[model samples]
Target chain A: MTGSAVSATALIWVDGERASALPLPDRGLDFGDGLFETLLLRAGVPQFQHLHLDRLAAGLQRLAFPDCLDRVRNCLQQAAGELQDYPWSALRLTVTRGSAPRGYAAPADARPRVVITAAPLHQDRCQPGAPVALDWAQLHWSSQPLLAGIKHLNRLEQVLVANQLADLPADELVVLDAQGHVCSVSAGNLFMLERGQLLTPALETCGIAGTRRRLVLEQLAPAISIPVAETHISPAQLTAADEVFVCNSIRGLQPVTSLGPRQWHDHSVCRALHEEYVGAMSC
Target chain B: MTGSAVSATALIWVDGERASALPLPDRGLDFGDGLFETLLLRAGVPQFQHLHLDRLAAGLQRLAFPDCLDRVRNCLQQAAGELQDYPWSALRLTVTRGSAPRGYAAPADARPRVVITAAPLHQDRCQPGAPVALDWAQLHWSSQPLLAGIKHLNRLEQVLVANQLADLPADELVVLDAQGHVCSVSAGNLFMLERGQLLTPALETCGIAGTRRRLVLEQLAPAISIPVAETHISPAQLTAADEVFVCNSIRGLQPVTSLGPRQWHDHSVCRALHEEYVGAMSC
Candidate 1:
């Protein structure tokens, strides 16, 4: 599903204070010099909270950001507590290298800023196992191992993909790396069921290592007694798979019903994975 | 030179009004969904104003941004008229796809926002033709043809380069593309002089097309009877070159005095180009 419009009912906090504006000099706005995490909030509780924070922490370390994990965690926790009224909502946490002089070199005593926004998601859009049509995006992700899987804010690539998606007939687009290897969906992780084994693309050189993707690979698949592997999957292999699905924190798992002319009617593997993952998320 | 501190004397404006805060949901902060131009303000006049605006306009078209060039031009002219007191300054003009819903897709009717900030520069730092030592950056630029040469806001790669520069003894770092082809210095375009010919890495795969670089390539070099070519350059070729220099709007040109152990004592070509380019910019 496309991103829901952030309604007036949305809650926003900048550095733990109730605010709706950021300094113009913020590195986040200046250079996209930051990291962000979007997690699902259920009944005021953030789903996969630790996983999101862990990813943010990893990204901070990768970007050589100052230690601001504790502050970010506090901000998320505080915002989630206030977002309990909405049964299903999306909580986006943004951590920037604060405001520095006009330069790429971050100040030695940089003070990081955290922005937390919680927006309500329609209940119907939050349901899992909905089948979606996919189109291959003409734009390919560039390989930068240093920034891969970090979910940092250099997302113009995805923005351009969204620009392409506006004119496409499909519900989502599958993006590949510069080498034309399958990478991910426009906004989620991709999985394929082949010969009773589930396969996902290894995000070594590109794509975000999504939190829900981790839940399925590390826990759900093992619990369901399905063999899973993270490997390179070519477009031909993807189209030839028995079942295909996309997953993210907000939209747990969506079965892919069609890709160009190829269609998969049987989504047994995707449904099973979604049910198990949802069951795990509630715990 | 490293970016100067945006001092208290700096002037700021947002959307044609004096302000220092941006809406929280601005796409620039969210997805870096925007383009920026950093121009040199000499004696209240922006050097290469049209060149910077032309590049920004091209980038806006590439990014599918809403048509806002006229507004941007108006903002720049208004700001330049107010900065007559600062003999030397840097004017950064940023155009973002305004505030939008939390998503990658740009709204059909995006209201673009412009942020203009003028920061005074130390007269000493504004001088051209200073020689700088260069070190090889361990981090390489990922090749994304779609985003190449556009000075968009997604600059985490350059931030990472600056991180590498902090601990290095060199004044600047020479970055390579993913394929190990010489791309640019940390914050400017790279040029190598060899056998009386000027060679610069083609920005088709990566690197920014700086306005000053354009001046040197299209005007200054030709004016001084030097042949220039935009082609792939290897690290070996760069080191073996007779002379090396880097250029950007803020810093007209800088001669490369040393790269590792290799040192260049003769900077006749670089000096000549710098003088001609400066003369052109002033006129």
Candidate 2:
């Protein structure tokens, strides 16, 4: 996720035309006034396309971007089809409030710009047994209940958290809200297995409501007969869980083998969820 | 700030050259992983250049953006020089973590991108005795202490707040934090004259640390003998103040004449501060 490894022709589109550059005054670059979605492409088709598009549409509504959901959905489908040569890939969809004259206030007639980028995806990252090590992020997430659950472009906190882990011997960083309740891992939503119930932190105050986490809660868990709940999770509760895992659209489900001194090798629950998610993706 | 009103040729620079577009993979557009400053250009020179650059430098350090402050400053000066025809103008300087492959994680070797845009400024917005009506913003600022003060590019909250005021008669919107404490106005830092002391909300948890607000606390108040303090301010305290005003680099200082029902016509304090700020900016 951190390299320039895309040697193949990465598919890119700006407002329906194939372009690789954006205007200097684009509001997305100016104020991060936009929303984005990252989807995993399996056999040239985006897995969980409906969930990703739905979240993007919701984000556009929240940001008051123009009603162009159908155009965006079509762009995503068309882009994915064009990049179908790769068996597996990653697709990113971004909808910005378009370019604007210098300012924080978005113009009333601003047309939303859509930018899509597709790259090859590595399948090994999602393998269940290949758990990732984690550490507490040195930085804390800001408590903006107004922005807690949506995947907007204002992600400086994530960038800061990820930067701190650059020198640490960890694959992921567990971030906390201003009040210090467990919010999320650096790049995904967190879920803990405790007393036979699947629990993820409530995103009312922080963290992105990841698409894979939604699938687990709304579909996969029920299909697999695992009880799920969303609630405030303290650091102590997270460490004390029998097993812990994180999920995002790109990386389906990865077990946390270690977080600082705490470690969990029993990833049976994570494996089951990953298998279910993968099976569902294929259909 | 919302309209496309520049009739003169606006100057733009990207990475030190005259350019009007950026590579689509820029992380600033992708994740809003950057900082920006909008400065007022008076007589072909950027006013408060030192303060604005210092703030941008501090933001870069906090966001872990690559250290390129000197280059950014030089670019600002160079770009502003190219657009010197307008006696009054606005210059926006942006520093992003450059472009990266699709992901939240920063590429270790990422080069920083610097973009500067210069446009004509309207003189009427800064008239000394012009008092503006205000209303409380329905949208609250998210509490992220880590990003509370710096002028980062993640400004969707400001966009949302301003959008709500589009149809309202008020000239500006007073925003509060998630905890209901007075935070700031929709676009600038707020100051209140209470009991002979000029009080501004502490930005420890939210709001941008505006450059003009900084100038007031650091220079104008001290030179004018008006005591200033930064502390937790509530709505009750704001309404009870003898006078209320807002400040930013572009608009200078403006007195708020009305807030919903409470009205104040006193221009003594705001006029004094505005005079001091104007005098200081000219030198």
Summarize candidate 2's per-residue lDDT along A126-206 as a digit string, tens digits: 455357999999788877676778899999888878888888999999998878889899899899999999999988877
Model 2, residue B100: C-alpha shift (Å): 1.8
Give the C-alpha miss distance for residue B185 in model 2, angstroms. Answer: 0.8
Per-residue accuracy of model 1 over B1-283 as CA lDDT, tens digit each: 2244234444888888888788778899998999999988876788878889889989999999879999998998888877766678888899999987778899999999999887887764345656799999998999999999999999999999998899989989999999999999989999999898999999998899999888888899999999999999999999999999988777778999999999999888988887787677652
Angstrom error of the Cα, residue B280, model 2: value is 1.8
lDDT of 1 at A254: 91
Tell me how far candidate 2 lies from the true structure as C-alpha RMSD in angstroms.
3.5
User: Cα lDDT of model 1 overall?
Assistant: 0.87
Q: Tell me the native contact fraction for each prediction.
A: 0.86, 0.91
True lDDT of residue A66, candidate 2: 83
Runs in model 1 deviating more than 4 A are A1-10, A124-126, B1-10, B124-126
Question: What is the per-residue lDDT of model 1 for residues A1-283, given as tens digits with 9 covering 90 to 100?
Answer: 2244334444789999878788768899999999999988887788878888889989999999999988888888888877776678888899999988888998999999999877887764345656899999999999999999999999999999999999989989999997889999989999999999999999999999999889889988998899999999999999999999998888789999999999999988887877787777642
lDDT of each: 0.87, 0.84
lDDT by residue (B1-283, candidate 2, tens digit) is 3253334544778888977688768898988888888888876678888888888888988887767888887788777766566678888888889978777789988889988888786674446745789999988888777887999888888888888888799899999987898989988989999999999999988898899889989999998899999999999999998999998888788889999999998868888888787778651
